[model samples]
Target: MKKLLFFIFLLLLFSCKKEIKETLDNNYYKKARICRDSKHSDSAFYYYNLAKNEYLKINDSLGVGNSLVNMALIQTDKGDFYGGIESSFEANKFLRRENDSIFRNRLATNYNNIGLAFHFLKDFEKSSFFYIKTLQYIDLTENKLLCYNNIGDVLISQQKYGLAKIYLEKAYLTQNSTTLSKVINNLAKAKYLDNKNYDPLPEFNRALKIREIQKDSIGLNSSYETLSTYYLDKDKNLSLLFAEKMLTEAIKNNSPDDRITALQRIITLDAKNYLNNFQHFNFINDSLQTARNKAKNQFAIVRYDVDQKNAKNQILIEKNFQQDIGIILLALALAITILWYIKRKKRLEQEKEIEVKNTQLKISKKVHDVVANGIYQVMTKIENQQHFNKDEALDELEFVYEKSRDISYEKTDTQGEEKDFSERISETVSSFKNDEVNTYLAGNDSGIWKHLSSKNKEEVYQIIRELLVNMKKHSKATIVSFRFERENDLIRIFYTDNGIGISGDVIYKNGLSSTVSRIETINGEIIFDTKIEKGLKITISFPAS
Candidate 1:
């Protein structure tokens, strides 16, 4: 009796849980449908995601597929073509093989959404491929007409006008529904683009009348633009009138491209005070362009992040089906570890910031000493003598420029500058050379740098220049030597100077600190050795890659 009661209790518990799950899933799905019907795309997407999550909990692949397809429609509507493509592919993957009517409908929707995404991306061949795929699952004449129209549009884009006309005509004959106006418009476009005698104005006007009766402001904007474009060459006055209609409808429908085109037509036809009128349209055009560019960039970034996350999740879920105990524990442990790591990291970051500041201060000092003094002397000479010396003035300015460039470690060998890298390096080295301290540079030629990657050469040049600057500031050497030699796959730089030998407490000054940082970044090795009687000896080695 006890065993039987326990069994009954377990069955009741399981059934109750299943009932609650089903109730919640249906609630979210119903809410999503209501939002979708109301054209609240964002709200619909949010509720659909809730439904998808609920379905995922129940392992209902069909429900999840439906939610994904629905979300993809919103994505495509928002012009996130790549994002829609990804979601549509997921829907197709899960729903394509299901033979039930609902699942088949979902698969058709996925195919259609994929086609729209590719169409927006201007990949007509790929768009046609997916549009054709929907045919096997979609039995609705209206939906089939949409597919035919899309295929025909792709053919028109490819300049296969004759073939396009056939499919478009089929679309026009498929259904006489309220949406058939768009199919007629497609047929007209095909005939007109093909340079045929099929006067598209009649069909375009017919579409305009249908949309007007339907009270679709969005649909009317397209119709108005079409009429304006079709009449632009035939009747200038009629074109201007239609253009005005297009502008009014575009403003009402929030159609930015149509607004821009309408503004251009008005600007052309209405020359008086056109610029004043254009100021408002220009602002609208700029806003639309900025929004589009921002959306595209955000879509790309979000797609990349979501793809990375989903790839990891898919792999983990495929390999493991157990309860998420490990993940939970990992998260808890990570939270604790992050607390201490962040504190330690903050201290280290502060130290690095201080070091960089000190380096910048050192550079400023060098700039003040070498640059300011040179300029002041030039000004003093001119002021005392009361004479203009263009050559001498130019020489002082060049000296100041060279020193400033060295201080900043900037590369002036831009492509348009027509400057040579070897020449730049030689100049850098010669800039430090003086009567008291001579700097010699060897193997800084094309042969040495030709095989090295641009990045590798840049870092190396920077490191060597920093070392030269430090030597000039502190080494007080009579001679400085720099040699670049390649051994096997390694590029070696051997630097020596006959200066006061390295002391025990050699400061990590700005120049030396930056050079060391560069070496570490490249995973290179550096050696420093000094003797009481010998000058500084430093050698660094890295790959030429």
Candidate 2:
């Protein structure tokens, strides 16, 4: 008797649990539907997710699929195209093939939403495929028309006009006014695109008439754009008129994309008012980008908050497991701290050794570039000049000594340039010129150096000195040319010589490698041209910002 009583009690408990689960899932789903109908997308998404979890608890595949479909629709509408496609694919896993009309309809909707997401993302091929897939499960005429039109639109984007026209004609059989206008517009566009001689003006006007009569502001914007594009080459006045109308309609409908399209058209056709239209285009484009970024960020935050909330709820349900996890995590944290401390101690020792080695390397490079190169330049001057000035040679030696002293103090070489950087650069380049080598410079105006940073100027000075040093030592050049020009925001320096050029497999020695590093430090680029049969050519470019 006691066993029978205990069995009955267990059955009652299970029955109550099942009833409560079903009620919760049903209530959550209904609330989600209400939120969705009210256009509260974030709230609807949250409730749908909750209902989906409840449905999973009760093993109700249909309920789970329905909730996921709703969530995906919201995501797509909110411009989360990738997230929408992902959710639709997850829902497809639960929605199986069935004889029931409702089940097939749900499956069709899921595929259609995925197609729509792909269409927005501009994956025309995948979009066409999914739209075709949607047609296989779709039964309703209106839905079938939508899928057909979508496939046609995708084909048109892919420039397959003939195939696009066939599906568009099929969709045109629909009596729905909105769908009819959409299909007619696309079909006419496809025709006009396929044959330049084809006059789609009649059909375009017909669609425009319907949209205007129905007071469809969005549809009217599309019509204006189409008409403007059609008359762009034929009649500039008419194109500008239509483009202005489109801009007005777009502003009324609060559509940034249409506004941008209209602005572009206006700017192209109305060259007199180019600046005004271009400014408006820039503002609208920036605002649209910012808004889309904000919406995507909000969607991410909503998903994260929901997941965290669900996790906390689960943790609350398993308090004993939470205590065990906390203890294990604490132990892991302590062990990590001890290991990190030991690693940090070893890292510090290694870093000190590396610092000393780096300092030694820097000193050696400075000695080679400054002191050695300075002495070499003096020797070249004395050897090449018929009447070498002793005072000028002494001044050059003093400059080298000052540089060597500053290298020991780790001071920058860019300071004390109030005398003018351009003059210094010219003096350095001319100092290398003699009877044997004719070094010519062009476009070395002080204006070119105005926008360069001090550090960049210093690096450029060093790079030029290094190149001259390399030429004196390696290349037996007779003629050398240095061209300096400012191309918009970039400063370009061109160096060419008439000597034995480097082979394609030439390796960069210490001097060349240091030049490369200096260019990189200034966010500049260098190219060595070894294809020249005679002399080497190197071009350096950097931003003037």
Candidate 1 segments exceeding 4 Å error: 1-40, 292-545
**Residue pairs that clash (backbone atoms under 3 angstroms), model 1:** none
Across residues 1-545, which tens digit of lDDT does each residue of candidate 1 receive?
01111211222233333333433457888898789789886778777767766666565777777777777777776666787788888767557455666666667667767776787788988977887886777756666666677678778778988989888888877555445776777678878887857788788888888888988675676677678778788888898898899789877767776788789888877778698768967898789768766655654554454433443344235334344766788799999899989999999899877966777678778889988998898888888887778798887886787687776654243221335667767877888987898988888776666677667767776887778878887888989988888866787888999998676566463247778889987779988876547789898998767
Compared with the true structure, what per-residue lDDT tens digits does model 2 show for residues 1-545? 00111211222233233333433458788888789778787888888887877776555777777888878877776667788888889788767745655567677777877777787788989988988987888766876785677788789889999999999999999887866877888899999999998999999999999998988787788789889988988999999999999999888877787899899999999889999989999999999878767666776766666553453344234466876887799899999999999999999889877976877788899899999999999999999999999999998986787688668535334233555888878888899998898898999999998878877888898889878877887888999889999988899999999987777565385247778898999899999998877998999999998
lDDT of 1 at 100: 64
> How displaced is residue 303 in candidate 2, in Å?
2.9
Q: Note the residue pairs that clash in candidate 2.
A: none
Candidate lDDT scores, in order, read: 0.72, 0.79
